[model samples]
Target: MSKIRGMRRYGFLASSIGVTCAAGLALVPGVLAGAAAAAAPAAPATTAGAAPATGPVTGPAAVPGSTQSLPLAPRAAGRTRGRAVGAALEQGLRRADVRHFSLVGVVWDNPATELHGSVQIRTRSAATGTWSDWQDVDTHNTDHGADPGTAERTGGHIRGATAPLWVGDSDGVDLRVRADTGDRTDDTAAEPPVPLPSGLRLELVDPGDTPGEDGPQTDQPRTGDLSEAATAASAANSGLAPLGATEIPALDRADTERELLDLRGDELTDAQRAEPHIGARPRIVTRRGWGADESLRSPGFVYTKKAKAAFVHHTATGNNYRCSQTPSVIRSIYRYHVKSMGWRDIGYNFLVDKCGTVYEGRAGGVAKAVLGAHTMGFNSNSVGIAVIGTYSRSKPSSAAVKAVARLAAWKLGLYGMNPRGKTYLKSGGGNLYGKGKNVHLNVISGHRDGFATDCPGRKLYAKLGTIRSTAARYQGR
Candidate 1:
């Protein structure tokens, strides 16, 4: 995608983040005043030393490491009249000459404004001069993998950041945004006109060779030295051996009759290691198996005994990737979540590709309640399973849905949760549910059910019923 050739850039207005209430949109006190007071140094309209060009330039200059803010101006191509209220209006599109960048996203400074817009981008394929078709970028996204009620939401480089979409191996780029005006139910007579968001930006994340470029690299596991005594001690204390660390190679295995005989009780029991938590295990590529470089994430694992539910989500990183590129996609998301969003690790506990292959997401054992940063208010007891692409309007592949069922059956059954049943999760805040609020949700639910936004998309959400039923069947219900 390319940035618009020439447009007058303006420093966008930065608004403090507002709370979403049942009544309607409400601004936090002194938020606007504080934003207005500190207008200067908010953020420059464009990168310093990079001059605006007059026309579209084909080749891009090598940018060492930069997050340039390209201001988008309203274009006349947008339709207004007779347009349904609250529907997102395509504001404008901008293109820039960014050579060799792996990640792309839209950013703004208005936290007070609920900007619901979708970004579509077309990238110039390096292998060929031909351009790719425009793909959708989730605009209603607010999840930056930040811890609930934590300053990571309001602090760091993500205060007003929209979810960053991934576009691998691209030089040319173009982006467009449409502010969501639907779902508005305020008393217009009493409330003043809501201000539109400003300081529009396109953050390009180029972290070099998509970490683990030479395929997946094996490293030391999360646990310390893997010895007979150590394994027994850790297993006795933790109730579960660190076998999940197998793929990462934290410990070496020396097969011997004596060693095999010694492994009798310390290792995972045959029943505990079986799939479906009841029957044959489904195929799952571990984080190490999928080539995840654990070096990019924080150490230590957060767990909750057992998983009660599975929250489905879309990566929202665009759908321009191939099944073969799934590893790279996961790696990029891992980096963005840790380095950019400042989370402990990748948010989701598992990721399913369109091809139906399931990959382990956060580092903890697949069977444990490895608390994920997904589903803002309910990450603790739930496992977040993110399908790799946007499914708002697009239909999820049958294989993908089946993969979800297989995963839900295996994981949910670990705690004896029927996929078709209901479960209660205590909210951790950062969503429509109040913190400490106990919310009853479907055992298999979309991200929207817990939050107040559209996630897992309508298409994917619609498939939850089938997914649940299939998952139940997989559990031999």
Candidate 2:
């Protein structure tokens, strides 16, 4: 069983062009905000709307790795629409010759709570040729407005800054923007001019401090414990172990039949075979435990019971071994969760071993209501599945990944789980697994996100987007 954690919060704000400020405020410099923050909030726009179009828009190439500062002030007092400013910035970026980038804007409120502002850019392409259609990357709102002092200030001070936006595959363009309040009109014609760098240096900041060190300076107190925990967990769980040298028990032909029988009509033909390979055979059920009482203590425990969501996790234990074979390992995991870490049973409702064999953990038939201990708040409506190895560093075999996908598809069909079109991969503070803002499927996520331990590694988490995408494809069919 794998440990699960919560998600993080990242705040982004948009301001008019002509805002100027320092560059140390984008993200926590030297720190990767956690996986918790990596999960995007409900985006107001379509997921496909987040990225720029493939063709070129219009405008000169903005310098790579340079700040394009803008100065802005509301035409009327007490009226600050950050969205309008964000739109202008998006247009500006689209006009610039940068590609594959992350854009962020910050609005700083003074002691009296006036909307002073800043912005930053991190690009992975050089400035050349024409601009591409601007895509609004993900945005977040930190609790900076929660502070009475910072929230009450007025007088729209525009101080924008752009961090050294690195064009990873290109020469690394740099662009900057500084707010100039001299012109106070609502139109771009009255806005301040853009700043271009004479020459730029593509210096790489330590990945650790990239967030906090690069953006506009702020007095906002940092809460980074969750971020650190997410990072550690991701690091620990990444990568797959080499095929273990030890030979373990193989699934009997009869046992395979029994497992498939449980699925009824959904079982695949290949799913019945014990050894598709001659040398090694993967076992589906290594061990089975029954509680003292037959009524409530069936062969399996209910990890979660929900008809809508699917929770995915990696067995932090090594790959050469199957989790079913090691009941002690599962017991240790459960003890740590229930007694020490404070969770119900080992988080997952079902466990998948290295050989792509599925074992029942929390059990409830399709007819009877099944509940799981997988996701914290939503377990009552989810099916928790744990793959037996760390996939962050090691990729799950094609067969294993495919097996999990197929199982999820079957479960989704059986349970009537709607494709929420929201990917839960961005679980732990937005850092656990996957990439991008769009959630392709409803509630499909990795384990490290729900708790603090590194159950599923990075390499495995990266594939989550594909998994959900595939699920969506299947569901569409």
Candidate 3:
């Protein structure tokens, strides 16, 4: 079957399963792996003798003008049987009826708490005025791992989540959800019933798409005071142009030659310099290269000292879009992260489109250890590379797979790590391992390896062996 056709088929299969098994057999942590839990990271230390904050968990307020959250009250909820527990949109959110919203996600309760639920949605397609089949939202999400000292964990409006599935240029939406009490302890009926997720919310996100309206203007060149000829080239190199107009500029041969002149000031460590040479860096479209509107983000990029491992993931936005729509898809995600989720920026360190195009994500330089919100409990010393589509049952394009290998080889070699070898990452705090526990993992691993989620999907996760070999070859291992 053609790629698009396969994606639609997957969508149909997902929806069918969702309708039939919405409550009974929803996604469990062990479905992907055999419940081999990683150690959760250690909790934050208190100040001197101060008591820990043990108050009720609160959700962050909705982003101003970009998103609105509507409550979803339970319908015929039954705790004992787990049969009558489901929630639907209080009022149907038809795209035709509500013309303003562009994206949707189910939000609830505390960021630190886990939510077990199945969500299915059907959207109207703009290409044909027909409504598409209901598709299952990726519910086994473990992307909430934030750095211990970072604002994202202790500060931001974090909450329980499902991957936000996009419905493009559509006019209608129907959504249903069933919350499962994920506890599987078998000590009889002595315990209090696991609280049905309180404050179940549906977030309607508006992308604010328009010419010169989606985001603030890109920053001007830092070399603005240079000669006009120099400044013009610098502006283009720095991604000062508007979004969508970016063409992923080629690396300047002269610039590369000059950088080669300095071996002492290189970002690579002394040990890495002594190791077998990996090939030169791969072509990367920087944040400036993709025309990211820097003014939309909080200033000053954060960085870790070195990246010891790379975690792979799928964006989990369905595979309905063409390659030409990649940039637009990225832009929408950017707006969603910053505007709707109240994140500082897009969560991944980099994004790979199906066409093999690599776009820089986050504000930090490509060579730096820019912390990302991709893997739960393991963000500190790692890099997250997300392919831009779902691959639960369908195969990923070869180009996308090749891109992962190339990017992994380059980034891992920078830290003197072998793409196919194992490395240790200290957990910040997660279901897998306790905080501060050093966990050994493959140098390049799927999101599921470190967190308890079926991310990067089954098909793509299975290809990690091939990806590892290809990357090792690239590193001259």
Q: For residues 25-76, could you state the per-residue lDDT of candidate 1 as single tens digits? A: 0112244224323321222122222222122222221212334445666655
Rank the models by lDDT, top first.
Answer: 3, 1, 2
Identify the superior model by TM-score, candidate 2 or candidate 3.
3
Regions of candidate 1 where Cα sits further than 4 Å from its true position: 1-97, 109-113, 116-120, 133-135, 143-147, 150-158, 178-199, 206-279
lDDT tens digits by residue: candidate 3, 1-477: 011111111100010100111111111223211211111112222322222222212222122225556666545433434333333312123334645454667766665555555677786655576887888877654455465445665554656666777666665666766655345545354343345455666666554442123322223312212332222222222221222222333233222222222211244444433444343455665553344445455433445556789999998887877675565566667666665455666889889988887887875445556667788788777899999989988889999999999888766755667888999888877777888999999999999898777789999999999999998887667
Sorted by TM-score (best first), the order is 3, 1, 2
TM-score versus the correct structure, for each prediction: 0.64, 0.33, 0.70
Give the alpha-carbon lDDT of every model.
0.57, 0.33, 0.58
Evaluation by lDDT, superior candidate among 2 and 3: 3
Off by over 4 Å in 2: 1-305, 320-344, 366-369, 418-420, 423-441, 448-455, 469-476
lDDT of 2 by residue, 1-477 (tens): 111111112111111011121111112222212321332122111111122112222232121122222323222222223213332222222223322322223222221222223333334344463333322211112211111111111112211112112122332233232222334555555555332221111222211111222221122212222222222221111110001101113433333233223322232233223211111113222112211011112122221223456667765444544323333334333332222222223445566655565544542222122444444333444567777655656887766665566556545543444333453432212232222333334456665454333445677777667776665555443
Give the C-alpha miss distance for residue 119 in model 2, angstroms: 39
